[model samples]
Target: MSRHAWIDASAGVAGDMLLGALLDAGARLSVVQEAVDAVAGGAVRISEREVRRGGLRAWKADVSALDDQPPARTWREIRTLVTGTAHAVFERLAEAEARVHGVDVAEVHFHEVGALDAIADVVGCCAALEDLGITSVSAGPVAVGSGSVRTRHGVLPVPAPAVTELAKGWQVLAGGDGELATPTGMALLRTWAGVCEPLPPLTLDLVGVGAGGRDPAGRANVVRVLIGTRSSPIASSLAEPAMLLEANIDDLDPRLWPGVLAGLLDLGASDAWLVPILMKKGRPAHTLSVLCPPTLADPLTDRIFRDTSTLGVRRSPRDKTALDRAFVPVKVGTGQITVKIGHRDGVLVQVMPEFEDVAALARSQGRPERVVLQEAVTAARETGLVVGAPMVSVWAGRAER
Candidate 1:
């Protein structure tokens, strides 16, 4: 099953704190170290130890720079070292810093977030999520804190200017004295977290607590990450509440439909598609349909209005059912491909290779997409993920392709 992680940043959040939380939750330190090493070239080291925050035990992740005088890297230079989620998080930070400093994004230099320790924290966090097989993430309202903090630019008000820029559209508060949320923490949350709400429903698996720099009285100076799995409705008789949002557009450029649909999905829509339709007076157009969890209805509806030529959106309640699904990686020659397995009850119902993974492997090997796909399916079957085989519990360490 796909695993989800809920970040309980109600106390506060920072890069090191979040990393410690993931480590406390059972992410292998070796995996995180390897990923960080790939990005930093041994310029930093990370270690975790038990610590106390308000009498509560938590893990403290410490990242130390191996080189005393690390280069003051620019956003452009830093962009070359990271990929995937870490890259996106830094991109968000760069843009926020640029907006706050009123400079071009490429001209922004690192006095804080660009340091080796920060790079380790970001890369380590991304590696930990992959090691733990967390495919989706969400969090509660962030605590930005109050008072003032000293920085390279000067003393800034609590929350800082860059953090305020990155906090746009997210729920936040001044939960305590001093700076509670750092720019790196806010960027990581905004980039990886799909939604900012209360704890979501899931089968509880593990909980991790990461301590901050201070152990203030009366409150735990820490961040928590809760990892668990949600039962997929696809294979269940019980249906989950959902919403179907539709918009009829005849004036939008036909070429924009892909991006419009993709944007909706990125905004947490469960599914987005278009259907051929003829409106009043026989006008030919497509009906854009977005199916999502009821909680996501508002943001997705607003996105439709912004991305499409639709003036209004129609919403309706829906009961969604789907088969239980899981992902497992199989080797096709030298490349790894993830295959999606669908099951009903406890029996295997279907097995299919994820097309994107197959396509990527094909591109790297300069082979036909269809050829790589066939090889992946054959590899999956050989690995005993065939139809009618009993469904088995697999470790949640397989990262999404």
Candidate 2:
């Protein structure tokens, strides 16, 4: 199973809050400190404290600098100070700031975010995430507080200009009476999270609560981090929620079916097929089904309507589980061919050669396609690649044929 981390920003988010949550979730303090110190030239120090908000306990992170007045930095200067994922986060922040202030990205100077403490918060949080071995990161809808906030530029509207620009195209809501999602927080979310949705199906492994700066009257002013493995019926593996769309058409021409199906597949459908069916009044029909990731559902649905003679389409969300697959090379005559291997629960379940590779070898060597396929399969088996029960004999029979 793949390890994933989800940030619950239901209340709000900030750079320190994220760093604190990562520490609360078991990230090594030394690792975060080292990363921040290296990037800031050992000019900043990190401190942690146990804090409570709305009767709930959490961790609070504080970053302090030895220099009284740290010089403001340009986007290019900051890029040279940090590297890897932290560098990417700053790049996003700089772009958003440039857009908000109507200045060139290279010429934009980070006023608040350029401070040593803010730098530590951003870089340290990224280093903490890497220390935890998280492969994927997601976030819930963000809460951008309603009232105005004081900034280096003076009292600005809540969710400040930079914050608003950073949150473009993301799920956001208004709440609290002050600035909730800061620009640093938005930059982290925008750069780190590939998906913005509610908590998905997962077996919870760890939970971390990070306290914000203020203690609201009734709400828990904190951000949460959930670390876990994806859950599914077949096995504990990496899975994603998808959509399955179907349309029944009895009036379309049979010759046009091939193009319609191909079009759906070409338009990003994970899988597409047509099933023969008998519609009302004993009319012969076909049910066109398309499986695709949720993000592509709308465009692919439009393509279906334009490409086929279907009046309506039905769609439903689906959870898909797939075995871990990889390709291994096997010698076929003088050329090498690739064999696709599928694994379930660390045991191989299926092995087959790339059809195009086998067919190409057959034509080049003047051998029957079946002979080339059989040779590839034999080579795979001779390498002692073992799989689980169901598909073993099935693939073996195909080789013998």
Instruction: Provide the clashing-pair count of each candidate structure.
Output: 5, 1
Candidate 1 lDDT by residue in tens digits, 1-401: 66778899888889999999999999999999999999999888999899999889999999999988777789999989997678878878888899889999987997878889999999998889878877667789999999999998889999899889978888999999999999999888777775577987778899999999998888899999998876663423357899999988988889998998899999999999999999999999999999999999999988998998889999999998776687888888999999998765445678899999999999999999999999998998777678875432222122321
Residue-wise lDDT of candidate 2 within 1-401, one digit each (tens)? 44678899989899999999999999999999999888888999998999999999999998898889988889989988887667767877888888888999987799789989999999999888878876567799999998898877788998789888888778988877799999898888777765587887778898989988899898999999999876653543558798999999999889998888888888889999989999999999999999999999999999989988889999999998777665767677698778887755334668788999999888988889998898998887765455553222222222110
Runs off by more than 4 Å, candidate 2? 232-401
RMSD of 2: 12.5
Pairs of residues clashing in candidate 2: 348-387
What's the lDDT of the predicted structure labeled candidate 2? 0.82
Clashing pairs in 1: 233-322, 234-322, 234-323, 235-322, 235-323
Query: Distance (Å) between predicted and true CA of 308, model 1?
Result: 26
- The reply for model 1, stretches above 4 Å from the true place, is 234-401
Q: What is the TM-score of each candidate against the true structure?
A: 0.63, 0.65
